[model samples]
Target: MKVAIEGCCHNKLEEIYKALEHIESVENIKIDLLLICGDFQAIRNTEDFKSLSVPAKYRTLGSFYKYYTGELKAPYPTLFIGGNHEVISYLWELYHGGWVCENIYFLGYAGVVNFGGLRIGGMSGIYNHWNYNVGHFETLPYNESTVRSAYHTRKYDVYKLAQIRQPLDIFLSHDWPTGITNFGNVNKLLKTKPFFGPDIATGKLGSIACDELLFKLKPKYWFSAHLHVKFSAVVYHDERTTSYSESKEMSSTSVENPDEINIDFDEELNNPDEINIDLKDGVNQEEKNKESNNEKTLQDYIIEDDKKEQIPCTKFLALDKCLPDRDFLQIIDFPEANGKFEFSYDEEWLAITKATQEYLTLSSNAKPLPPDNEIQKKIEEELRWVQENISQIEAGLVIPNNFQPTAPAYGQQQTFILQQPFKNPQTEDFTKLLKIQNKINPEGQSPIRQD
Candidate 1:
């Protein structure tokens, strides 16, 4: 299966599809799935602009509204995460993730799904320490603070992602993992964006939460955007780094175990008002960090499964934002797992969601999550429930094609304010399938609770 990876879409659906079409027409190769790193502004109508956190000049309706209204359709099966610049109010409606439009899927604030037999996971939004430990407290009719905080990466999502013990084929994040520069070509990257020198030197360039997930998930491929330069690096998870418990630290307010290695965030980053800055150079650069004593390429240290099958080292790539002549898209083919594959809900991820939904908070207060043993028990129970109740259904694990629009499309004039979140039927149906509470909307009801 050939999949296309695009970085920082900036609401360029039409341009992206056109580029893909040109690739297919010229190379005569078909692309199966389109995975966008972030900045996919899924703005539906003019009302969504109210929650967007960009400068007034930067806020303009892009091509997504056409796709939303079914005037245009996506050429390939697409999945995207959120970034700092997004229709926050619209995205918050389907916080657990749903079809932003037919053929185009939002991966939620953070989510995992199965596509073509590959287990793909993604965490949306750029990381900020001030909001990292807080809950999903931001609501509809957002204020100045909530507008921005609504898109900030939260600990709840990261903790759920951290619970995944299964091996991942691929992982996506909007920001590069902190300390990722250490493994990549720092000198060359600094030469290009010397402005990053201070942050890089102080170990503050990327996301610490992402850094934790990288070592824990240990996916074969990791893709990111946000800093908007095309960069490549390979991370080897040897005995020294694979032990995640030893490499990460947790504060009193954190969700992880307290015994982990300390990854300190600079107190200066706590400023909630700092504007997001991007490097628009769009230059392509390669960063490779090998062991100083004895270099080891990806081939040297293939991770072995219980059956001794080799899994390659994690290959990390961060692409540039979509622009003319920018290195924003790349295509790669994965060997067929089955004759063909369709979109399906990941069982383990579903179990994790079910296990953790009760802890979902709409307050700014930081709370400790359940301990490892308790969480493992809940997951096991939920996993069994999912197998019997969901996976055993006639249609099985395949996702249903039941997308329906809940909001007005662009150019559709309206008199009333969209002050409250729309109770999307897709999300309602999804939560029903899992028998978990739909915590996305305040008024959302769960089948379990209903019963």
Candidate 2:
């Protein structure tokens, strides 16, 4: 189906939707879904602003408040991943990922969601080697130095995606994959932003973990933001199949023998709400045929499933941030699986989350990241746990209780705060909302255990 893709939102929801609506009206085409890359500053209230990791100059309400106040609503269902410039204290609450509102979904720090039978995988935050293997322990009330820790992409999440043998239709990240410079018109890109050349030459442009995933996962399409300039590339995955991975460290993070790759497809995706693909009213029959044939599991499409062919090349697009007259937004078409594919947590991924618990998930006000040695040791331990227990977890014999699943940051649970919100948000009201979130939660639950 035709989907609208935006680069970095920076909380320009109203403008983006307005543009989407205008395009729909003009083209007479019904956009099925809206996918945002990152830098989605979901600053609903002032407390959210405080928790955001952006510099003071860049931290201001764009248009999300109107959506929060019910003054406006997105014209279509929206799905987005997290980025470096975000109110991560709020996102930290939804660690497993959930709907931000009725039609808005966050794809978690690193997650896979099925939309219209399309397996869309995403990695949140930019990758920095210093914080790459560090545990996801950075929490709320972050000081200047500590805030950067919140956006550092962790290896634990990447490890989960790494376990998937099935190919992903699309992948999203806040930053461009490091080697993307090689696939695209890097020389022309330098004309727009010359300073980027130094980083590109030194292989320091984007995330190293992301680069590894691009080569390893071999997704059909990879979309990103952060470098706010429109760029496109086609990565030939099959060209150098053996050398796809340059890093021995990332290549070694495989959970092969321990995982029962042949998971029961029956119980795989029972979560209807997560992957329901309802077609819009006005879509044409021709459009249906063009966009309906999605590649789900290795077995979902039997056309050529028997052979293990080298995966197809990946199309990479990194769009510019949301601003007036930015030539970054684009519309693209992708196939949807003809048959209903189950939408559920990937078995290995679920196992990793359950087994590793807080090591992969940083709770609000949790401890800071451990030192490098401790980080490496913990990662080794987590990997071992996944390798040993993945099969049991897949078979329903093991489920870890240490994980306190994250709560939804929006949706019905948060309607009270949005009830007739003041158009011009006052500090007192924002404070009250903050108190409701942190202190007197009507949900009768707190993220932290009461001593």
| Candidate 2 C-alpha RMSD relative to the actual structure | 14.5
Candidate 1, residues 1-451, lDDT tens digits: the string is 8888888888878877887887787778888999999889888777888888776667778789899878899989999999777888778777888888898888888889888888899999877888988998887778788888888899999999999989898899988887677566677777867778776655567777888899888998899988867777766675654422245443212222121111121212121111122222221122222233265555554532221234246778888766665577888778754434567888999999999988888898867899878998999999999999988897777878877776677666555357667777888889898888777775733211110
Best by lDDT: 1
Those runs of model 1 whose alpha carbons end farther than 4 Å from true positions after fitting are 242-312, 339-341, 414-416, 444-451
Q: Each model's C-alpha lDDT?
A: 0.75, 0.60
Residue 287's lDDT in candidate 1: 20
Worst 10 residues of 1 by lDDT: 256-265
Residues 1-451, model 2: lDDT tens digits: 7778888877777767777777777777777888999878777665566667655655566667556445676677688999877877656655566555445777788887676667788989877666666666665457786677778788777766665556788899987776576665666678988777666655666777787788878888888887787777766655544322373223222111111111112212121111111212212223234346674444544543332244467778877766555554777766554423223334434444443344443334323434545444555555465456543455322212122222223332442232111111121222232122221112333432212
In order, what is each prediction's RMSD in angstroms? 9.2, 14.5
